[model samples]
Each structure stands twice: as C-alpha cells, then as structure tokens.
Target: MNVESIRLINFRNYNSLNINLNKRINIFIGKNAQGKTNLLESIYMCATGRSFRTNRDKEIINFNKNEAYIGAMINIDNYEKFIEIKMERDKNKRIRVNKTELKNYKELYSGLNVVIFSPEDLKLVKGGPQERRSFLDMGISQIKPVYKYNINRYSKILFQRNNLLKSNKSKSEIFSLLDIFDVQMAKIGTDIIIERAKFIEGLSDICKNIHNITTLNNEDLTLEYISNVQLLKNKTNMEKEYLNKLKMNFSKDLEIGTTEIGPHRDDIIMYINNRDVKTYGSQGQQRTVVLSIKLSEVELIKKERGVYPVLLLDDVFSELDEERRKYLTRSFNEMQTIITATDVIDLEELQNVERSIFYIEEGKLII
Candidate 1:
C-alpha cells in the first residue's frame, strides 16, 4: 500500500497545500518547526482517524483557522482509495471514503494501513504503561478494524462502571449496576485480551529475530503482554475469569473510586536478557527495542494484510547511528517510505534508492 498524494487545508501551519508522493521514497527535509512533521500528521490522521501528537482535533487546525481538511489518495493491492477528513473547532470530525461518509472514525481503519515511526515512539519503550497499551491497541486495530469497536465498547463499559463506583449512591444500587457492567465489560475485554495476546506473541517473535540481527546477537529482546485478568487460552473460560475478578475487586474498586482491573490496565513489557528493558536497559538498548517493534509492525501488517503498509518516518534518522540508519534506509527500497529529517543524514545509504526530496519551509514545499 502507498499514498499517491495528500492535500492539506488549514491543518497545523499548512493553510493550503497539495503534493504527490513518490511510490518508492519521499523525503521531507527542513529545519525545526518547519511543518515537516505536521505533513506526516495529516497523512496519519487520514489513515487512523486520530492525531499522534495530540488528542484534541482542534489542536491540529491552524490557530487562526476554525477548521481543517486533510485528503489522501492511497493505493492498496492496485486499488485506489480517496480518504478525506474534516475537523471543525466545536463540531465532530467527518470522514469520507470515495465520497461515502462514515458514521465514525473507526470505519477508516479498514481502508488505509500505515506504520509510523517517530521520536515519540521512544515512549513505547521508556514511557508509562499507557503508552505501550496505546501501541498495542493501535497496532491491532489496523489489522482488525473490529478490534477498535471492541476497544471502544470496553472503554465505555469501564467508564460507566467506574462512574458507578464513584457515585454517592447506596452500595446495593451500585452492586446492581455493577452486575450489568461487569458482564458486558468482561465479554468485550476478553476479546481485546485474546486479540492482544495473539498480536503480542507474533510481534515478540518477529521483534526478537530483528533485534538479534540489529545487535549482532549480543542482545536478546522479548515482549510480554501483562493482563490484569488471568487470561486462559479459551475465550469462554477467560471471560468467566474476568467477570469473577471484576466481582471480587468491586469492594476494592469502590473504596478507591475506580474500576481497577481489565484490559485497560494491562501492559506490554519489553525485556532484554530477561531484565525489564525500561528499568535496566541503556538508552541505546531501549531505542533498539522500539526499532525492532516498529519493523515487526510493518512485517506483521504485511503478513496479515498481504501488502506492506506505507511507512512514515518522522525525523528519527538523526537519532540513529550510521549502521542503524543504513539498516532503515535499506528497507525503504522495498516499500513506499515518507521520511522527515532536518538535513541529509545518510547520503551514502540513500544513493541507490529512488527518491524525491522536498525542502519544507514553514508549511510550503519546495521540490
């Protein structure tokens, strides 16, 4: 899959811009704060229906504008798709594919598959559990669009259950409400847990192999999914176990004013040589772990979707050593890759790749 072109209007600093993308490589070169990353953000939003940098839609709109528009033409398996997203300051965002309006953002997942690697991804290794969870959720949702619906359902049920726990209502009333929420939450949460477990297992295998090659077999990387519920191999049994755990934790949850256990509280742990990478690994090691995971994502998406997802690299080349940079550039030869960098970092590795370079300056592109 590849993006053929992208159009931006009032998005971040880009008041009005339109550009075609190269099938092999498209490089955006510029100084800091030159709308290099903002261009990538627009494409990502068209793919995943959310901004990677901020959750607020209004944040992506130019400060002086009340609305923003992003459109992209993508090719998947030789079929072209046009996706458009419109965001208003106080109104809900609208999404359309081939001129057909979608009821919600989740519907966009089925069309475009993108794997984005940015400096913020370092958070996948060094940041809190929420970061890892977001990584897992987003990655899975791409291959299985229904997974997003399940996650959304689980979140809503969890929210209501937490609100009930925090209420000043009588314990009897809360328990009655909890009874309804736990069953629903467990069913959806169980599906999410099973899906995540499968994805993590596959991702771990690929990442381990990639990390081994990248580090010359000196470091061993492994990924493990940690769930608040003791997950059984069978979904039916796992759902029962989840429901029981929710019931058992109700008293504790009531005391704390929050629902404490479920997929939302789960985490992904990266281990290097059996030690938690986040806790003990060096900065270089953590970076290697994130690199392995991202490359694994590209491979996994291809394995599941039968086509490589478009790769978006946002100013990450500067952080990598020449060896790592060469490794990344080499992969660009196989798929469409859009990269952003302050300046040319590895001209040697870039020599053989067919690429188009655009100098971005304050939201304008100079080819």
Candidate 2:
C-alpha cells in the first residue's frame, strides 16, 4: 500500500496543508521543531487512527483548537482508498473510509497498513517493558483485527477485576470474577504470546542479517520473547497455570490496586553475543537493532498482507552513518517510503531519480 496524498488541518504545527506524494520516495526537509515530524505523524494517524508521538488524542489538536482533522488517499494494489480521521477534545474520534462513516474501529484496519521508524524506536530495545509490549500489540493489532477486539475485552475485564479488588470485596465474590477473567485472559493472552513468539522468530532471521550488514559483521544479535508465564509450552496446562498465578498474587494485586500479572507485562529481550544489549550494547548497536526490527516489520507486513506497507521515517536519517544510510536506502527500493529530515544532501547522495521534495518551515510546506 502507498499513500497518494495527505491533508492536515489544525494538527500540531500544521494549520492547513495538502500535498501529493510520490509512490516511490517522498522526502520532507526541515530543521528541528519546524513541523517535520508532525507531517509524518499525520500520515501515521491517518493509517492507524493513532499517533506515534502522544497517546492523548486531545494533545494532537493544535493549541486553542477544539479538533484536528487528517485525511489521506491511499493506493492498495492499484485501488484507491480515501481515509479520514477527526479528533475532538470532548468526544470520541471519528473515522470514515471512502466517505462512509465506520461503525467500528475494526472496519478501519482492513486495507491501510504503515510501518513507522523514528529516533524514539531505539527505546524498543533500551527502554522499559511497556515499550516493547506496545510494539508487539500495535503491530499485531494492524495485521489481525481480532487481536484488537480480544485485547480490548481482556483489558476491560482486567479493569473491572482490579476495581473489585480495591473495593475490599469478599474473596468468594472476587474469586468468582477472577476465575472468569483468568480463563479469558489466558485464552487471549496465550494467543498474543503465540503470535508474538512467531513474529519474533521470523524477525530474528531478518534482523540477524541486517544487523550483520549494519555492523560490518562485527556483532551478532538475537531477539527473545520474554513472558512472565510460560504458556506456549503446554496448552492444556495454561488455564491451570493462569489460575494458580492469579490466586497467588491476589493479595499483592489488591494492595497495589491493579492487575499485576498477565501478558500485559510481557517484554522482548535483545541480546548481542549472549549479553543483554540494552545495557551493554553501544549506541550504534542499539540503533542498528531498531533499524533491523523496523525493516523486518516491513517484510512481515508484506508477507501477511500481500502488499508492502507504507514506510514513514521521521528524522531518523540524521542519526545514521553513511554506510547505514545507504543500506536503508537500498532496502526501500521495493517499498514506498516517506522520510522527514533536516536536509536532502544525504538522501540525494543515496538515491538518484525523480522524487518529491517538500520544504517545511514553521507550519507551511513550500513545494
């Protein structure tokens, strides 16, 4: 899939803008804080109905504005699709496809696919477990809408169970609800674990090679899916294990006023030469690992969807070296990529051809 054009209004620094994009490579050049990242975020929001920078939808609207709007025309397998997103401060967000309002969010995930790489992605390896879990959840949600539904349902159930615990409810009363929640959580959580395991397994194959190329074959990388509970080992024993763990942690969870154990707490561990990369790996190694994961995401999405997902690189070129930059440029020849950077010299040196270059200053795009 490729984005043909994008329209933004009252989104971050962009007041009002509309621009057509090249299917191959479109570059946005601007200095820092000049709305370069905002442009890429707008395209990501249009594709996923979520922002990569912030979680609160209200923050996405320009200051003093009650709402923000983003629209895009995407081409998937030679078919054109129009996607529109409206974000309001006090109301639920709205999404429309081909001008038809969607009744459910799952309806929006059918055709649109995008993979975003930004400087912050380095956090996937060095940051806390939440970041890694979020990475898995977001990718899975895009490819499998059912995972979205199950996640929402499991989260709701977990919330209610936590509330019950904090209310000083009787053990018998809470236990019943916990049993139901545990059963459901294990079922959904196991599915998530299974899918993530498979994804990481597939990703390792590509990441290893990519990391070797990026590091001049000096370092070896590995990705391992780490979970609080081992559910993949025995499907028949999963329910029992889930129930026992919840029971054992009941008092602790009640004291904390939260659900403490489950897939929500899972994480991915990155190792280089059998050592934890987050703590021991150099900055260059961390960056290369992130790049490998992202490129692997592009390949995985293409394999599953039968089309390449649109690639969005937000100000990441400045952080890469010349050799790595060339490697990234060579990797994008088979996919559609939109990159934002402060200058075009590096990009110009990497590839030679007809490309769309937009100059972003303040909130204006000078074509």
Candidate 3:
C-alpha cells in the first residue's frame, strides 16, 4: 500500500497544501512547529479515520477555520483509491472512499493501511495499559475491519453497564438488568480477547526475531497478552470463561460502581530475557523494545494483507543513536516510508535509496 499524494486544507497549521510522494522514501524536514508532523497526521487520518495525536477531531482544524479537509490518493493491491474526509467543528467528520461515503469508521479501516511510529509510541513500553491496548486494537483493526466493530460495540456495552452499576436502582433490579449486559459483554468481549490473544501471539513471534537482530542477538524479547479471563489453549470455550468471570466479579464491581473485568482492562507485558522490560529495562532497552514491535507491525501487515503498509516516521531518529538509526534507515528500501525530521539525517544512511525531500515553514512546503 502507498499514498500517491495528499492535499490538506485548514489541517493544523497547514492552510492549504498538496504534494506527491515518492514510493520508496519521502522525507519532510523542518524545524519544530512548522507542520511537519501535521503532514503525517493527515495521511494517518486517511489510513485509520482518526488522528494519532489527539482524540478530539476539532483540535486538528485550524484555529481560524471551522472546517478542515484531507484528500489522498492511495494505491493498494494495484488499484487506486481516493479517500476524502471532511471535518466540521460541531459535527461528526464525513469520510468517503471513491464516491461512496462510509457508514462508519470501521468500514474505513480497510480502505488504507499504514503503520506509524512517533516519539509518543515509546509510551507503549513506558506508559499505562491503555496505550498498549490501543496498539493491539489499532494494529488488528487494519487487517480485520470487523474487529473495529467489536471494539465499538464492546465499549458501548461497557459504558452502559458501568452506568447501570452506578444507577440508584435497587440491588435486585440492577442485578436483573446486569444479566443481559453480562451476556452481551461476554460474547463481544470474548471475540475481542480472542483476537487480541491471537494477534499478540503472532506479533510476539515476529517481534522476537526482529528484536534479536536489532539487538545483535544479545538480548531476548517476548510479548504476552494479559486478560482478566483465563484463556485456554482451545479458545472455543473462552466465551463461557469470560461470562463466568463477569458474573463472579459482580459484587466487587457493584462495590466499585464499575465493570472491572474484560478486554477493556487487558494489557501486553513485554519481557526482555525473562525480565519485565517496563520496570527493569534501561532506556536503550525500552527503545529497542518499541522498535522491534513497530518493525514487527510492518511485517505482520504485509503478511496479512499481501502488501506492505505505508510507514510513517515522526522525528524518531533524533531519539536513537547512530547504530539504531542505521538499523531503521536500512529498512526504508523495503517499503514506502515517509519521515519527518527537524534536521537533515545522515547522508550515508540514504545511500543508494530513492528519495524525495521537502522543506516546510509556517504550513508551506518548499521542494
């Protein structure tokens, strides 16, 4: 998959812009706050139908404008698709692939495939469980569009169930209503947990080898999916396990006024040589862990989709040493990569690689 071109209007600091991208390597260089990362965010928005930087869509619009637009022409499996998004300050953003508008963001997941790595992604190892869960969900949703629907439905059910727990209804009435929520949550949550488990299982295997290579085979890496429900080798009965857990946790959940056990509370534990990377790993080890996972994501997408997703790098080289920087740039030849950097990268790293460079200042591009 490749993004052939992108046009932005009133997106972040860009008032108006249009650019064609090289298929191999396209680098955007600029000082901080000059709309470099904003360019990548626009392509990502087209790929996943959401901004990677923020949850509120309105924040991406220009301060002087009430609306913003992003249009991109992408090629996937040898066919060209036009993705159009219209964001209004007060309403839901509208999306269209070709001329047909998507009914929901879930439908847009398969429209474009992209794997993004930014400075913030280090949070996957150093941050809370939500970040890790998001990494799993976003990575899976690209290849499995229905996974997005399951996530949305599960989240809605979780929200309603939590509200019901906090309501002023009698214990008997609340328990009666919870039975229905419990069954639905179990079935949907089971789907989520099962998929997550399988994804982490596959991603773990791929990340292991990549991490080894990046670390010169000096350290080992592994990932395990942690769920409240005890998953078995045979997942045919996982739904039952999840339902029983939810029912068993009811009194505790009632006391806390919230649902406490499900996929929403799941996490991925990263281990380096049998040691918890989050707590025991040094800064370099943590960075290596995240790098391995991201490279593994690109491989997994290619494995599942039969095409490499567009790789977006947001000023990540500055965070790495010369060795790790070379390790990352070496892979740029394998797929279409767009990078944002505040300064020029090492010329030696770009040797023999086909590339295009664009400079940005105050939302304007100079090629």
Q: Across residues 89-154, which tens digit of lDDT does each residue of candidate 3 receive?
A: 999999998978988765685467889888888899999999999999999999898999899999
lDDT of 1 by residue, 1-367 (tens): 8899999999999999999989999989999999999998988888899999998998999999999999999988888999999999999999999999999986676367889998888899889999989999999999998999898888888888888898999988999878889999989998999999999999988999999988989988998899988878878998899999988888899999998889889998889999999999998888878888999999999899888888999999888877778777778887899999998755687887789889999999875
Instruction: Encode model 2's per-residue lDDT on 1-367: one tens digit a residue.
Output: 7888889999888899999989788888888899988988888877777788887989889997999999899888888999899989998789998889987554567377889999999889888999998888788777887777777777887787778887767767776767777777777767777777877887788888888878888888889988877754786587667767888888788778888778888888898888899989899888988998898888888888888888899888888888888888886768788888888755554457556788999989885
Model 3's alpha-carbon lDDT is 0.90
Model 1 alpha-carbon drift over 4 Å, by segment: none
Residue pairs clashing in model 3 are: none
lDDT of 1: 0.89
What lDDT does candidate 2 reach at residue 253? 84
Q: Any residue pairs clashing in model 2, and if so which?
A: none
Candidate 1: the clashing residue pairs are none
Candidate No. with top lDDT: 3
Per-prediction TM-score, please?
A: 0.98, 0.94, 0.97
